[model samples]
Target chain A: MAEDHKMTYADPWMLPETKGFWEALNDGKLVIRTCNDCGRGHHFPRAMCPHCYSSNLEWKESDGTGTIYSFTAQQVKGGGKYVYAYVEIADRVRAITNIVDCDPDALQIGQKVKAAFRPSASGQNILVFTPA
Target chain B: MTAHDARLVGAYELPYRHAPDKSLAQMQAEAALGAVADAGLSLKDVDGFFCGGDTPGMGPMSLIEYLNITPRYVDSTETGGNSYVSHVARAARAIDAGLCDVALITLAGKPRTPAKGSRPMTDSNKPDQDFELTYHPTVPANYALAAQRHMYEYGTTSEQLAWIKVAASHHAQHNPHALLKDVVTVEDVVNSPMVASPLHRFDCCVITDGGGALILAKSEIAKRLNRPSVKILGTGEAVKHQGAGDIDLTWTAGKWAAEKAWKMSGCTPDQIQYASIYDSFTITVLLEIEDLGFCKPGHGGGFVAEGNLISGKGKLPFNTDGGGLCSNHPGNRGGMTKVIEAVRQLRGEAHPAVQVPDCALALAHGTGGSLGTRHGASTLILARED
Candidate 1:
């Protein structure tokens, strides 16, 4: 079903601050930046910690497991149905990802999910989630 | 002496239709000129400007240059539909501080009639592109996520959401300029094509090519104008989140922004005779009404389900111009139109069928960006002078 659509997903435009997160994704690892000063974690990487304005940040591998906070079964204008959702990867941190490998209509809140990496139409690895 | 004393003396809505021949600049110029004329002021009296749009080469400077006005103040706060409401508050503050005397806030766009060589409407630099775009979430899908969550948490039924559309369409029937005036029902909305789960096409706002303008002046200047004026009694603005996460889906920045506006206005929710709450989506109106203290949290769906928002029904009249749901939404600046409608209602100038009798105070509120993620909320309270 995923291959039916001829859509091409391009690699994200990397900024100087976000290079590390994309590089880690390429290495088959999910990483989140943790603030050294405030002991907080964030995603879609930023240069400085959103909490406490700390520039002292460190990268750490995540378990890549989260719970579905909310989701929508989206039927695009010409595209097929897909489940888009906000999955909480850590305390107070959520990542937007697609829920693949399951009936989109069957998705429920608080459902446990795990990361699954797949090659984009352009051959760049992208992260998706599936029922754990 | 308070900054909240600014007055809106002039309001204009450009002919709401698809005029491909009219450039955005031309539409903006017409609306600006019309508003100034409505206030019985010459163009030279304008010393401040505010605008927001996504069309190429659209900004405060471009408008300033096009109008050829040397203004003492300018603002281009782009927070989607809520931008213009924020401008109203900022304009009031500027006038109160003696930074400017007459402020012209305008919005124009041609989303429905794109030119032959126009650029793609979607821009790639949006913050959500980093993550949320990868999942193929359309505007309707983003709101559907909130509707879904609201249903899960508070048992908000799809039928309840549909009632909002029905009420909007009912109001549109009286508005000659509304794009969709035919009456709609819960069945009509439920049977409409599903854009995203829990949100049908009818649940979303109509896209059109139109513009609106508002002229806010110092109370003294407004009093001298030959036209009716609405006072900016109170205003509040807030932004909770910007991207796909971090904020609660069921709640919006309106909770905080409306709280401040209510405090500053010294007016309770029941005192608001007319409301022009932004309706970028049906769920948006429900969430805002709840956050603004019009009804209890988790009870918005039921409150609206009782037909309380329908014009001439004796309840709080909302979106009396038919709202974005049925009237028009040119890009993300529906907030400007909301202000225009509220002003019209307070002045006893609205379509007679939809006008609330003896309307003394009005509220105009808007939400920008996705409800599921980070977004901006703005609320403005306006009153008619005795």
Candidate 2:
């Protein structure tokens, strides 16, 4: 994908605990942090399980198959247009992302989607989604 | 002092179109002074101060100095637009606890003004900022997410949501100072340029430069004032967020807030003649109506369709002053005006064309932040004191 197509938003201000999540995306794979203590998973890789407050967390590669929970295309006046959505991925964990390589208008809730790694403004591979 | 012992003796929404010449402080100070004088009370009478994020400088300290009045008690809770709404509960409790006799709550903002370059209020360093901001999650983006989920969940349509903006336009036509007074139609709303899918440009509220203020006094002070006082019957506030990724986007925390306010006020939805629901977007009013118990959760589409929220024409007259949708949204916050309009309805001081008949009881509610994510909800119930 061309660099100009990425969202105008700035790159992620990474933290130590969540660095591996972004690194995996750069390698064209998606990852979710899972709580070893409670068997729950979370996205955007947190230090602890938000569900159970357990610090027993580990990196787990995800197949990146998901269903679009809700989606909307933001068309900024005189600016770029992109579709951002919450896709229920990694066993129902909602991941914030954009739906790329597809028609924004054709997207629907509950539509099946798969990961598409695209270059972000900072040249990091950002994980987006497209119709599977 | 007892619960519900505070009465709104004064409320003033600056007759705002645009104030490019005014500083944020000037707007807020003028609003503060306006309410003080409206209550027939002197500036000396304000011994308590309540403010939110819109206020310039460090909390209320700078504003207190700018106003040149010393308030012995103060609260500077900043919950976006819901700050002023929640301030009402804080001010009333402070007054009841003898923290202050006369309390002044103020809000001012200039978001509509062309920016001279400034950063957002929230730092980009928040834990979730990096994760969310990169997705281009603008204000409309967040609400559009909820709007889309709502449509999918309850078979809601773009046309049904357009009715909300249509109703607001009808009421705005009666308000000369309304930012949009042309009286738009449902078709017009649905056809407006789409800024965010499930949300047309017309479905969104106008961004305007203006401010408003409120004055709450102890019941005795209110009785002494010559102005008609609106008694604060009940107040409730709640917060909502995506609970551990089990996020629900269809409804807001407004249900929880409304329930608490209803239980406190001992009043039901049937008793409210007028409503000042925050209209950040047309979809917001829809969800709020359902959450406030005006109708069941999924029935909001039908409840607002066919001109259900238009003043003097619908079952409930909402946002007669046009709300944040048509009227000015100072500081880009919608909470202060909701409280101000409710007070106007309760005092029978609203524009006569849109005023509710009898106008005995009214409700004002505010939702701050975004519906798609973490947000605060506040609700207030007020009644006329004969």
Candidate 3:
């Protein structure tokens, strides 16, 4: 019975959209997310809100500036590893990010932080944060 | 306000017990008996059963069948780990709607303690099996992805995460029923062999075998039974996703539940006297504290490391009976113990050595999985009227 089942295969990381996002990051300029409409600031680039069902949303250049609303340390090892942080930009939106190149102990809550581009484990310029 | 209309008249939960080899039915029966006695009632007094959907223990109908409960109301509400306490609000509505008078909530059995791979195999019976579990990615691995992502995005350190173990173990030292009461250090958490990358042995919650139960009835039932009434002040729920792609991972849905719960209870985070957040892992609690608005976000690691979760001097007195991380975790029934702790504190019945003073409002938060993919979360507010 087991042999009758052909193994179905899939790759988790081969996303066309993610590849495009990474390409933008490599230029040290966060991508201007292109969506159907609703031109505005989209920090974590996405084609849809999954909310208003308004696929009509476009990404623009954010100041790359925000404040650390909350964060936690992860001890479990693997790439994509660093202190996870929630950055609040433009008053209401929060994006998940990694804070790097600083003392882990020194990062504080509500401290101003800004995002910068760096080559990520995925071989793309990913936006990382540092204390402002 | 008339006593008869209050949603919660009486509630009682027994001290948690560890009995790994025993069947779920037996534990439920024992806990049910204790709850009955606490309310000055008997099994005959109970008219309903509510439990998580797929616990190894008895389901509401199965418990009714095995225990001969014969209740008119039965709830097998399974969102995830918070299922039991979530039952409280539903049971109250059921009682208010005159479906039943007393709802007996019970959970039993041991899925955590090592027993030759008794882990509930992922449900692969569905046609979507190819999409869900055919890849051999287990729950821990799903959590591992979130953990790794958190590490990548935040630069949160091993020492800070290890502090969750260090701090939880400190609270466990005072809990007589805790499975691991010996205090551990950050080194112990770091050195422990990795279960999945970024998660060490101590970072993960220990598997435990235990049973807990609670009795819930209308406000009038409290006066009639002569038991102190700890009203079910508020309850709330939030859903993230059933699959990985839908999960945001770092920003939890549980805190959203807590926010609604606080609004429903008419209480603020600072007004809560004690908290029993479900601790499947230390990170879960850390995130919860922030999301619940107890501490500013990102401050959870530092808040926990600085002895802020301890009983006497911390900014908040938390999990005085040891949390699921240190206490017994019988799958989703972990919520029962959390509510029980709140009830005890509100009734001024906790072991005097560990009890909080004048505790009128208590909060219990439950989280089901890592980064909570398919996460089910609920926050319950219980209060004692002066």
Error of 2 at B39 (Å): 0.5
Per-residue lDDT of candidate 3, residues B145-258 (tens digit):
555545555666767778777767877788787888988888999998766556677877766666667788776776687667777777787766622122355657777888
DockQ by candidate, in order = 0.58, 0.70, 0.05
TM-score of candidate 2 against the unseen true structure: 0.96
- Compare candidates 1 and 2 on DockQ and give the better one: 2
Q: Of the true contacts between chains A and B, what fraction does model 1 have?
A: 0.61
Question: Model 1: which docking level applies?
Answer: medium
Best of the two (1, 2) by lDDT: 2
DockQ of 3: 0.05
What candidate 1 gets wrong by more than 4 Å, as runs, is: A1-7, B1-3, B54-58, B116-128, B242-245
Model 1 pairs in collision: B241-B374, B242-B374
For each candidate, give its TM-score against the true structure. 0.94, 0.96, 0.71
Clashes of each: 2, 1, 26
> Comparing candidate 1 with candidate 3, which one achieves the higher TM-score?
1
- When just chain B is superposed on the true chain B, each candidate scores a TM-score of 0.95, 0.97, 0.89
At residue B53, what lDDT does model 2 achieve?
76
lDDT of candidate model 2 versus the reference: 0.86
